[model samples]
Target: MTRQHVLRFYVALIAALTLGVLGVGVVGVTYLSSQTLIRNLFPAALLIAVSWYGSQRRVLVSESDIWLMGTVGYIATLVLLPFPLAVLAVAASKGLAEATLLAKKQRHSWKGVTVNAGGTILGVAVGGGVFASLNGVSYLWSHQLDSVFALPLLLVMILLYNVTNELVVVGAITLTSQENPWSVFWRLSRAALIPEISLALVGIVFAVLYHSSPIMAAFIVVPVMFSLRAFESVATLRRETVEAVLRMAEHLDFRDTSTYEHSQRLADLTRRLASALELTPEHVEEIVLASRVHDLGKIGISNEILLKQGPLSEEEGDIMRKHPVIGAEILDSYSMFKSSVSIVRHHHERWDGKGYPEGLSGDHIPLGARIIAVADSFDAMTADRPYRKGLSVDDAVERLKAGMGTQYDPKLCAIFIQILMEEGIYAPSEAVPGELHLIAGGRASGGRAS
Candidate 1:
């Protein structure tokens, strides 16, 4: 589908989900005391605020939320309030979150808000319905319910809530992204399961304690939640920075009809290669981001020059070689991309110290840059360009081998080739990289020395 068609379709889907949830929620609506409503605002809005902050960061693949605080709010509201009241509390919190997002101009698109609000409402409704059906409200409201039984059932309730939200959000993502539903489901099935469970238990503990010691729960537990939020804040900032860099990168690729194919393919390959080399997750994420925007400096080059099909004149070559420096400088301006700047600055540097911008050779070059160099060259060789048909993947692999020593890091290139040969593709693998040995500055591991 065209971009407009996709947007129009998702808008309708979001509206439908929203309206349906509102309709079902009406049935659950009942009068709650003013005191209960007032009390819920504290946990609900505070959680929402933290959640609002957390939402600034996005995760990969399906691009759903990772709001531990928000999840806690839903579970807490369900455990503490009646289904109808919990629904309102959840809605109120979400409404407030939307407002905050809008006021700060932090929201990227209305579609994102719609998907978030719609999926959340539906999820809460389903979770509340399940909880109420299981006599959970009775247990929660009663003063004499046994702790042992309540705790176990509360776990089930939390699971139900989490699953309901996950399904609604994941389903929407599947439909929008056109990713395989089964594959998405399997990937997300185990994603954040532990964190969800742990947060649910925390919510249960809070609710149970709130009955007798509201102050303690509010003081101790809330602070603990804030601590988690602190970490999430750092992550959010990092993600937001990377996202900005990506937007700039996309703009560089936007004018062409290929839809950023070169960068995207390179990024994907580099990620697989990084994994096979036993790089840490953070290292992998940085490498992937760097690979995607490694050529970002090309945007600064003149289109007439960049579009030239044949070999460039020495002067033109000099201009082209300036991209790494430009890209690195552009990235360096962003504090979050400091580490990535190193990779971008050095991606063109060769094993033999004969490449552009910097002539750093061998182990002196950043490992991530080495990885990107290989992936970038492979994708460039295998992807069709204006000048010529691309090479076959096998031929591309052979080309990589041909340049293995002089152009790329021998170890990283070998690991990438080994992994590719073994798996036949960069498909998801349960196999971890062989093993890793600590390298200089510990940026990239030596990985069992090949």
Candidate 2:
């Protein structure tokens, strides 16, 4: 389905889920008290503020994903309020905040707001229903040792809430990106699960404080806000580091346009291969990162050797091979990029043991490196170089097939070939190279050492 259709369907699904919960929630609404009703407003207003603040300083997950840090508010609502009231409060506050705060220029702003609001409503309603069913609310409202004893039930509530929220967000992302659903879900869960649990724990604290004295709960928001700011600061720092690396990669791209373009195409193909192989989100991200900077060591290569038109002489080749080690060393300084360092260093290593800095054969080489090798070889063959014309996509496939179990991991090569054929990109460059090359990073320089 088209993006709009998918979005419409998603919004419809959210509405259906929210309404389904609401039907049962109304029955539970009678459980709410006048004092509880008044208390609900505090969370609603706070959620509005949080949502507005979060929208302004969005955490970038990827082109298609944004990490929303409003879980505390939702969890607080679930803990302090019951059923329909909690769901209604979330919908009203989140909807108002998103409508006011979301950029007008963003596509599907209204529909996205609806999905966001409805998703929160469904999560709170369903989670609250489950919590109430297990008599979990007594833990938050009652005296000493209640919450301590009910820890297991509280955990279950958090899980259900997060799972519901994650499903809605993941479904939207999958629909919009047209990526594999399982991949999208895994990526979201890996990044989000810890933070969501932490926030839920904080929310429990908020609930406990509110039960003792509403004023105490109000005071806790200050520390919670500060903790969120710390999370944002760390995320910002990581983003800046990634940007710095990309800038360096762009500098390398400038040195040899072909090599840069080769990185770009190779990154794309490798990501496809990694995802196809069902690697974890973390591994997939590492492989994609390694593909982009696989030639980073080339940055250390002399201009004479780097810009050399023909195949390198044996001496030049020796210098060129050192790029992987140089690249890994450069990346090693950053803790966040450490996982990718091995992938970068080993990307050129061959399956049969003749390739690169490490002659470790087969599974001994990092799997990420193995995936990049297959993609790197394909992009190198198909990419247009100054000296020799790029091979046809068909010829590239033939080369990959021939190199199976030797130059490349046989499984990776086969999967990549299947990706090409399944996508009908037998001649990608002719149709739309820009659209086919779908990873972040800039421009073309196709050559890389085989």
Candidate 3:
């Protein structure tokens, strides 16, 4: 199994075991008349709850996990003594989980995860220590300090702790991912404050309701902030990655043709097909990128072959087949483009295994490539070419229908035809005088015919 699958399985197993243990402990506590059973059960319950909650959230655990665990830890410390020391232990756990999850999600190296977790732990320690010191001072000056002063001070400390918790979590994750700490901090801070503010308000409500220490209620803020921040961070990363890929696609188009209007049209068509196929946004993006760079391998081919006046000879055709391979190689060099390379390499391949360098066919072909092939073929047939006048959209649709299950993927072909028909995309070919002359002139134009 893949690492992700294994991790998920392990998490599921742990959660199940924790629940089982908690169940057994509950029974034991009820049967046995010992306070020890109840005491021991609380810690186990806290551990199980925290771990299970963290596992289930996938992206971010509920803030309650940290609060409950911290509360239990603090209570343990307090009966032996007193004060809000439990909050610190809870905050530390929160920081550690945040850092670990971030590292895993970002695919950071082990060393990076270690450093990030360590940093988070350190930040929590410092923040918790400061709060503890202030709390001690407040206890000592109980008679001297007024309720108004003490309440405001508690609020300030809670706000500081919540802010610091967010920063530490984001910082550790970003550092582990090798992203700039400042950039991560700034990006998250800008987008995440609303959620933090909301959580802070909730903490205020809790403090008012309890009429106890504000610091105890302050624990609620940590999880709320962490959840919001983590979700926003992940969403932002996805959006940025998609935009970057789209920009790269635009670059590819600009390098080949002055007008990327055709690329835009193809992108629209691809999106429609994707929706019809019920593809996820991630899959749609992959398809779009693949379609955008469908002709990328042409860059490696000589201008003569790419701009050939007439039909390619047998030898020339052989050279043309290499374009897909070359394109795949170029895309494979970059990590971001890896998902798109297969589509680029195999868009020319036929469903029947009769196409290109590797004739492996049927389900073996990548679905993204299959979808692009139909779109590419339809676009190519309808677009003006050096050797022939562009076919009318109606004609292009007919040609695509004719080639279904032979040269193109049947399912994708049907989708493309449906899209074209639905959008009223088929129209009579528009002739350009220059383009006609260029095609008619053929070899005389030094292969500028196309």
Candidate 4:
């Protein structure tokens, strides 16, 4: 079956199970005292409203994951209300948010809202039920657990709730999106994990004070929300700035003939290589950002030169060579992109001091720029251009090997060739010692001229 069909089936099954659970909770309200119900209902409703607001002001964490504060709302509710009540409150919050979205003329997707709510409620049900089974509803409804001093159990209970919540949420997200649930978990679990622990601690502290003064408990939420907003602004600015860089790169293909994806492929490979080299995540990310706009200077070159079917004239070549400096100058204006500016300016530099712009040699060139230079050269050879046909994979590898000491970093080029051979991008049979030696130096770079 198609992926959409698969998702629909899962959604239907989840909806049925969720509805049944909520139905059972509704039927068992007789077991809850009116006083108990009255005490829990307002906090539940208030948290629901708060969660809906958070959902509206969510932050994107990845292409797949988002940082929504709804879990913060649910965690607070789960610690103070019964398991059934927690589920109902969380679900009600989602339902209410959808209504608000509709009122505002936004697309309140049923799949987006329902699956997420259902998964969250399911997780709370599992966690809280386990907590109640072990200690009854004492912690759920009283201040006793607050002073228990049994830190381990309290932390364990909090962890159980958060972990269950994460698994369910990820599953729902996986079903709705193209990303693998496990991969998404591994990638973002850390980002969300720390925040979840901090928020859970906040909830536990708030729950303790809640019994003393509901108004004070209410007051705590305002600062927390504002703090999150402040943090969100910084994170959002970074993401939006990266997006703007990508949008600027799209200008490379003004008439729809530019090899825009060439930059994308180079960026992907450059990041991969940086990671393979065991570079820090920060350096890898900087390399990625630089690769995205490495060709930005091409925008300043006239279309006549860019679209030329033959070799560039000396003047045209001169204009083409200025792209790296132009790109670096443009990026230098943005202080936030300082990490990438050097890489853009020096991506054309050579290990043997024959490269353009500054002609920086060897390790004198930034590692990020060296990585991009290799990636850029490989992509240029492999990609079909108006002036030349694309080279075969073997020819590209051979050409990169030829340029290793002069045009590329010898260590990185050797490593890159090894990677290509291992991935079978180049024939494994060609990986004999004779070929290996050729990668580092023995052969003349001018042995085969284009």
TM-score of 2: 0.62
Local accuracy of candidate 1 as per-residue lDDT tens digits, 357-389: 879999788778888888888778878888799
Error of 1 at 355 (Å): 30
The alpha-carbon lDDT assigned to residue 81 of candidate 4 equals 75
lDDT of 2 by residue, 212-289 (tens): 777787787686777678677767787788778877877976778776677777878887877765454555776787
Cα error, candidate 3, residue 120 (Å): 25
Candidate 1 residue spans exceeding 4 A from truth: 1-11, 24-27, 30-68, 141-147, 222-265, 268-450
Question: How does each model score on lDDT?
Answer: 0.67, 0.71, 0.53, 0.70
Among all candidates shown, the one with the greatest lDDT: 2
Model 4 residue 67 CA deviation (Å) reads 2.2
Q: Each model's TM-score, in the order given?
A: 0.49, 0.62, 0.46, 0.54
lDDT for predicted candidate 4 compared with the true structure: 0.70
Better of 2 and 4 by lDDT: 2
Q: Is candidate 1 or candidate 3 better by TM-score?
A: 1
What is the descending TM-score order? 2, 4, 1, 3
Error of 1 at 178 (Å): 2.1
The lDDT of model 2 is: 0.71
Report the Cα lDDT for residue 135, model 1: 82
RMSD in Å for model 2:
8.2
